[model samples]
Target chain A: MALRREEILESARVLFNRWGTAHVSANRIASDAGVSPGNLYYWFPNKAAIIRALFAEWSAASTGVALAGLADSGDPGDALREFVHAAERQPAATARYAFFPRELFALLHADPELAAAYRRNFEAGVDAITTIAQAGIDAGLLIDPAPRANLRDVVVTAWIASECAPAFLEVIAEEPASGRGSGLAGAILRSLLTDEGAKALDERKGARGHEHRGIRAG
Target chain B: MALRREEILESARVLFNRWGTAHVSANRIASDAGVSPGNLYYWFPNKAAIIRALFAEWSAASTGVALAGLADSGDPGDALREFVHAAERQPAATARYAFFPRELFALLHADPELAAAYRRNFEAGVDAITTIAQAGIDAGLLIDPAPRANLRDVVVTAWIASECAPAFLEVIAEEPASGRGSGLAGAILRSLLTDEGAKALDERKGARGHEHRGIRAG
Candidate 1:
């Protein structure tokens, strides 16, 4: 049952990403999944239920990768760089769930249960970012000169920019692939950093570049 | 005829803003406009046509405000400030057309003519911002040490943040009014400013504060 459910979700994700949720009907999803409508319904009550499940899975996977990156890095700058890179990669990582972000507002407004779940996930994401940013500050690798409330606002703003800007721009502008990495988060982070923090971040980037070259040479 | 067209568009905008474009039907819009369905059709062939018209009007108003602010201000810093303020106020200014931003991608995808118009407007907006940023640099009020491409990218990112961040966050997280002024654009702008630029911006802000106080006292 679990395996079938996963298969159904995978099918739905592909269709949703390709054509969006509104265009793809439940029967189409079942056909795409190579399952009878009755079988698909047995596994998932409705398309909304499938979307909810996919959203939960995507959110968990993204948060898990972010937390893992944080846990693996000892240096605060390195951790932050890793976390941001992970976030930058998230759109591609969950491309199957592309429909979710594009239709996010309408979907959430339509389903209270989904909205509540999404809100919890959003809060968790914010908390994780706050923790990482605070750690950077503690390690003397970040400087936020704003008052407490203002600093929090800046962090949240940076978080939103990093997580949503690329995807949002992609959908709205239909921008070329070359236009993808605006590095808005990096710009925001630079504004928040002390000189020491800037140096540390540069050093971390240099080290990562060297590691990448070493791997390529090997 | 034009007056009735305006009335129908206004009615559709309100309904769309309240309940999204997909859920609001043509008949509902016609009823809300206090017009017959035939009359509504005479003005706008369909709901998409009405949405496109509203979008065009909203874009024109926003771009006009930004350009007028730029043209009026002698100081680059002042111009940038005014532009940001105008952009920030846009969501509220066009609140009745909120569905356009929320469903931007889908709407553009659905209509090539609308997509072309939007692309032109977006490019014009970028050009205006770039011109203002360049003026700031020439006046020694901004420092963008980045290469030409990177500098353009940064400006575009800041523009997107200023224009879309509040509306996007409100819809996604149901964030409070306190969260409204994340000042993402301000942060990005600060990062791009030279020391002199930062000081000039501060002085301008201080002067504006005094002006506000003087107005209140008078």
Candidate 2:
């Protein structure tokens, strides 16, 4: 029963990501999952329940592994890379939830419960970035070049740049979401880096050069 | 008859922008416009027709007026401001079409004809930005700091930054769309400016200081 539930969710995610939630129906999800409508309903009472379950998995994946261990590293470059890496790792991780980012407002409008949950997650994401920026400032690894560069504004800029990247990639750049917005987000964040921060980033990049050798697009 | 048509379109735009197209119906539009469902059907036939008319009006407005005179400005800062001004002018102009940007993909997925039209407009916008950036580079007003800063990529960045600003403003920042995304978009573009470009921008800002004095958030 647990395995069947997972299969239903997996099918729904693929269909929703491909055709969007509006176009997909429960029967489609059930058939794609190789289950009868009754079996699918047994697992998820309705489409909304399936969506909520998917969103839960997405929220957990987003918060779990990406920003996990970098906070203790105390190096702003690593922290920044870790932030960019979250985007770089999208294909392997968050890309499964691609439909969420694109359909964010629509989904929120449809589900108040999801909207409240997402707002809390959004605030937490902002706070996490703020913490990282403050640490960077303390370590002399990040500096504000603009006279009125509020850290909050900077964080917001970073947030928009990163969060909106996948949609940007797909729509504007006509690219796949594999690299996500890593290059753009990293460039925007790098603008905030001090000379020392830049040097540290260069050294780190050199060390990881072999790993990211051909992925210059990122 | 033409006046009534405009009223119906105007009413539909407001309702769609406020609540999204999915939630707004033809009957509601006719009621809002103080017309009968029969009259609305006479004017638009269906909700899809209403959306197409709005999209047409939006495309014309977007391609007109704002980028109209700036290409010949010769000053990159002026050119850039004109680009940014397009967003600044949103509350008075394009903000009526706010629903389109936020619901872009969803709308496109629902209507292939609109998708094709949008892709064409998207290309034109990108080309316009590329031309401006190239001119700036030639005139020593813009510089590519990164080794691999392709003009197309920079244009793409600016395009994403500006085009996605309204959604970013409304969704993430929880702000109204009056200023659109001038600040963040301008900052990203400014990161690509040469020293000459920066000085020119400051002088222009000083000259127009009173005009934009309190609206610095843009």
lDDT of 2 by residue, B1-218 (tens): 98889999999999998888989999999999999999999988789899999999888766653364265465555676556555445445656798987887677767877777877776777677766667667778666434333455545554555556666566643642123334555555565566676676666566564644432211
DockQ of each: 0.27, 0.25
Clashing pairs in model 2?
Answer: B183-B218
Clash numbers, per candidate: 0, 1
Expressed as tens digits, the lDDT of each residue in A78-187 for candidate 2 is 67656555545543565778888778767876787777776677667767776776777777876643443346555555556555566646653365212334455455
Q: Reference contacts recovered by each candidate, as fractions?
A: 0.13, 0.10
What shift in Å separates residue B89 of candidate 2 from its native position after superposition?
2.3
User: What is the C-alpha lDDT profile of model 1 across A171-206, one tens digit per residue?
Assistant: 555452235553554555554555566666566556
RMSD list, candidates in order: 4.6, 5.4
lDDT of model 2 at position A136 = 70
CA lDDT for candidate 2: 0.67
List model 1 lDDT by residue over B136-171, tens digit each: 788887665343225555555555555556556656
Q: By DockQ, who's the top model here?
A: 1
